[model samples]
Target: MSPLPGPRARGHRLPMVTALLLALVGTLGLTGCASLGTAAKYDGGRLRIDGTDLSFRLPEGWERRDNEELADALAGSEIDDELAERGGISSSQQDAILDEVVLFAVGPGGSSLNVLTSSEALPPRAVLIDQVESFGGTDVRETDFPTDVGDSFAVAYRLDAQGVQADLLAMVIDTGDRLSVITVTTGSRAETDRVAEVIRTSLALR
Candidate 1:
């Protein structure tokens, strides 16, 4: 058995893990994501998303995905193949499910964030626990993860058996009327902190 990851490998924080996701934001491009309604643009100095109340601007160096075919956009990245190889998870299956929930994505693939809305309503913590386990998560820890998303039940963990042995940060934000999931995965533990910070400040509720 391998040794558990140190604190740095654990992650910073975010919303919640769902199906363990990614795709480089760079490959997708700001121009490609420049569609009319769903793109992440500062409206009156606030970043807004089309389908959800959640909003958060990407970090200075980050890119936003405006594409409707989120999974296909992600398919252009290497993270899925890594997940498949390590966790025995299927990329096509993951993509199919993601296509349904993905509202916006950030990053350049190796490290990234995905925001998806769900109405599954199985209890926030329960849903969070189950999804992490499903994605082969390990070393799970509850987090205060820094977010404006409101009393989020967040967690950080190693994406066990997947993604080049990377870290994952997830959050489950429940607004009584809706639930928004923020999922991030990286090729290294180091990326987790930065991505989590992105999630923390990303929400721009409409």
Candidate 2:
């Protein structure tokens, strides 16, 4: 819709859904671990499924990061321009929310993962549908993804900007407490397939 906003050498106009995937991927691929050393709730080694004792392992080479790294990534990104042009959330607002709750992962070959959750009392299914409904992308395809834990939702899409295509996979998992939005973006379809395999196979009950 917004002409894809000048295809950043590295970035996306990430919103809650957008912000979680696009911007973060841009940052991870754009800059190295800017945070360098800090701990976040969700480490790349394993992430606990909320409202359950189950925890799943992230694929090797995935590094969990802190918000500071995200901030650093955004500093060198064109994500702001994309967001502005797309009529998405302001950088400041995005920054604030990002600080509150976001589990990030930087993986091999310019791939990234973003996790966002809310503790506010609400139905998980409703929130998941809301997130999916709000998503906007090119060549979008969605389906149910079955995990060892349960049936989750997955969306595959392409975000094209400046001739650079970001192949993305967004998986929404609802175990109980609240819905969890996990997004993965890669530089190509092959890469996407590899990463998706790692996630689907690696995600399991602790």
Sliding window of 10 residues with minimal summed lDDT for model 2: 6-15
Model 1: lDDT equals 0.53
Off by over 4 Å in 2: 1-45, 49-54, 120-136
Q: Please write out the lDDT profile of model 2 over residues 1-206, one tens digit for every residue.
A: 56654321211122345444444344335334333455344445667654454455667777776646766655645755564444356767656656644566667765777766543332344443444345435666765577776547677666654445677777766554454566777787677767776777777666
Per-residue lDDT, model 1, residue 59, is: 57
With a 3 Å backbone cut-off (N, CA, C), the pairs that clash in candidate 2 are 14-18, 14-19, 15-18, 15-19
* Cand. 2 Cα-lDDT: 0.57
lDDT, residue 203, candidate 2: 73
The total of clashing pairs for model 1 equals 15
Residue-level lDDT tens digits of model 1 in 43-133? 3344454456766655555555554646455555554565455334476655545565555555544355666665544244655666566
Deviation in angstroms for 150 in model 1?
A: 3.4
